[model samples]
Target: METKKHALLSASSSHKWLNHGPIALLEAMVPEEESSEAAEQGTAAHAMAEHFLKLKLNQASVLEDSIYHDEDMERYCQDYANFVVEHKESLGENTLLFIEQRLDFSPYVPEGFGTGDAVLISDKILHLIDFKYGRYYVNPENNTQLLLYALGALNLVDSIYDIEEVRMTIYQPRIGNVSTWTMDTGPILEWANGELKVKAMQAYKGEGNLEYGDWLGMTKIKAISKDRAKHHLELRKYQLREAHLLNDEEMAEVLSHVDDLVRWGKDVKEFAQKQAVENDKHYPGFKLVEGRSSRRYVNVKSVEQRAAEQGIQDIYQHSLLPLTKLESKLGKEKFHDIFGDLITKPLGEPTLVSESDGRPEIVKHDVNADFK
Candidate 1:
């Protein structure tokens, strides 16, 4: 497995830390977690893209061996490679292509560095392409990560190339999205010296106030994908269920839209609570009040010292952290790397779900099968 070095204020995580600088402090307490399967898959896709881009651009590159390749990955990666190289070709002979380029934006962001997927530079244009394998629709406009990458890329050839404008492109082939955001060199340098420097300092020191809904942030692509899936399933189910298969009770249960109802109920409750708590939004028939809480320690250290002074022996009990909390703290990759072969996910209790759910049904056992 290839290991990656992640800086405290890495460009990839610029979105999180930039929004609320103090999160960098909170994250420092937590170890790097094991990357989720999706993250690893994305890495594999990047490797594949690098392989193809190198081959297409006449640069020596090896196709990395990994378990994450699929038909979609191959197709998307090839297309992205083609897009990058083609864009370079269109820019003419003056354009130079750099793949998987190492970028250092530390002048603005302290100790900051990142890898640009593709950097095509001409005398007057510095084109930075970032390939996102995920389904999320990453907007190119004001994308902090891409902006930082563009800055880093510019720093590399700025003195040599009279790059008048920097064009940052987010090439997300999976979602058929190709977005570009452009900024003149003067404005970018101004932002770098002004906003970027301030934010980077705040992030470096982990000093800014926490942003509300940081944890609640969800990618637009996920929401889009879910809605699209639900729409298709809703339309398809009508055709599939032309004839009734269930009795009255079962039919009524299906008609209740239990899944949607449960989801909506939870969402509404959560949404209202967040609004009332965070924004002080006053909703009809609802008032903000402190909820019930079990007693714990105001300060664990203070309580411990007091207990010791009062001769309160055995005041502590030890137990392993819950898996979910541990996973969140350590990250999926680090957790798995440290505790490989020690963790297991047992079969969950089966429950009725809509046909649109991705999980496969458990095989049913027939008692009469042996007799046959």
Candidate 2:
């Protein structure tokens, strides 16, 4: 039997288990969600990046697929490969680079292991670069996932090289985020001995109680523990029903849980739909039905011919080519030379978020100030 992708104590999900160690035990009972198209695309992107970084040019260009292959993917993967190679070269000829390196960190976390996208070991520093193809910007500061990968890489190479520090990079080219963080091996080992080992043990033996928080955002815990999610959200409704108004602090407290509750509700609905469609799983009071469909011409060329016969010479749509398509055709230099002056970006509508969110808080303004 194969080891499950949702390892009880996987490095990728250290953030979740570290948040609440007992959630892993609860998570094991829940079936894994089917991979989404976005995830499949990310896999394809990673494969492309790996090929470019590990193979010669003749071999790298063979990733031909209509479904996920496109100009943007090729460009991004090439950029990632270039970044990794250039960085490795900067470290000198003695630096060894490994692609898709499997690492084990069981010394710290019981049964903990994961694959690092790329790892470079030099004289004193071991740099681990992870290629993130998703649009979500991953920061490298104190990220438990990256920290765990760093530990695993150090464990793999420390015996061979005298590594002093572990440096990790998160390259998310889709959002143009290349974030890096570094820590000395001594502190990393200290953390591994302290918080990491404690959480891993607690999670492995199923020893802690599940609590409600934003960590629920990770594993769709709502599917298995719908009652718990509902109960947690019930406080918001109970507070709303009370015959008194909430002040700033109380409202803020209630608002904190609303986002997670909404996400959980949506996940539950979608999970049921996927189960029904993919696995033939049935849900009471929720029969699957076809959605409304739109009509389209089956033979567009025949339709064009028929329209032309009816004296409809202009029975066609005309619109400017998308900026990206035009740019690719004209090349970046020519495209910018001609249309750079014509582009404008309007301010986006404001969105509410947690105080801990990295984006700068939106400043308030008065409508009358512009006229004044």
Candidate 3:
């Protein structure tokens, strides 16, 4: 039998659509492909991690080669395995580990389900570990996805095991982060019954207040809710008329609300472009054209040799220092050992961003004073 695919209110996107119920309806209208090539590669890496875990579990398994297989994947998987081994005591005696485990939280939601990367079940605690191969930091604290997974796993094993506290972990080895959030079963269930159930019903039925918020749940829908469309139009009009004329304080105040509209515009543009190419949708005046490309040396060794023969002193002109390329040349461990504490990342230039952006804001201690 084939497995069930993710529902519209899938646990992974609960953090978004749960916060803003209307996005679920909007998302249903537009066709969406898998997010990106990075998502596809993440899936492949997940399969690799599953295979590795199963092998360690004494199951018949074999390592498979995939386009996504690389040093990062290998390192991340190994680190995940190490975490599992190191946490054996916490898992209690005679613990069993499940890989690529399907968990269902449909009791609270209409069609809520998610797959956990690793589920360590024991008498005392149920550890729900998720592997994130992406460079972005995924915190486990107050993470709806992890909480949903924990709830589902608890529901599944409530009868069999005397599980008490649930440990939700996000293992992002690429960023050297392993965050764990623990909560007792009583509170987790309380949250599901209170906040999760209410929000989920609102999203599932698509009947709730429709207002633009700081949540990252905007979708590409031309004729969305009448109220929402009217508000967006007004905001756009306001932006065009008086945005540039605003003082610093006024600009900052306006930005908090206007950022959502700006992001929605970007989402709409992206959606139109994707639809035109992927589904061959026709636009009145726009035609799909080949994207711009840049020339690159196919064989760097040959190019270097030819350059040396031609007496070119600088084969690589206008080059910038890239840490990845440097690590590739010198080997990561060796490069780190040599440049230890010598290389430092400078403070990035301040830029306005939406509140939904997960990156920590640079809290400046020193500020330039000037007349307003």
**If scored against the real structure, what TM-score would every candidate get?**
0.58, 0.79, 0.75
- In the range 1-372, model 2's lDDT, one tens digit per residue, is 886565578877777778777778778877766789999999999988988886632344456564776677788888998999888989999998878888888899887889999899999989999999888778899998888888888889877998898899999998999989989999988999998888789989887656765656677566556555765656755455667888888778777777876777787788788889988998877799998999999999999888888988778789999988897777666888999999788888888889898889877889999998
- What would the TM-score be for candidate 2 when compared with the true structure? 0.79
Candidate 3: pairs in clash: none
Which candidate, 2 or 3, would have the higher TM-score against the true structure?
2
Candidate 3 residue 186 Cα shift, in angstroms, is 1.4
Q: Please, what's the RMSD in Å of model 3? A: 5.3
Better of 1 and 3 by lDDT: 1
Tens-digit lDDT track for model 3 on 115-208? 9888989887989889988987898998999989998898888889988889988888778898899888888899999988999999998866
Instruction: Please identify model 3 stretches exceeding 4 Å from their true place.
Output: 217-232, 235-245, 253-265, 274-322, 328-331, 338-347, 350-372
**Candidate 2: global Cα-lDDT?**
0.82
lDDT tens readout by residue for model 1, 286-321: 898889989977999998899899989997789999
Q: What order do you get sorting by TM-score, best first?
A: 2, 3, 1
Candidate 1 runs further than 4 Å off: 1-4, 214-372
**Which runs in model 2 stand beyond 4 Å of their true positions?**
1-6, 55-66, 235-257, 275-290, 296-315, 321-337, 350-372
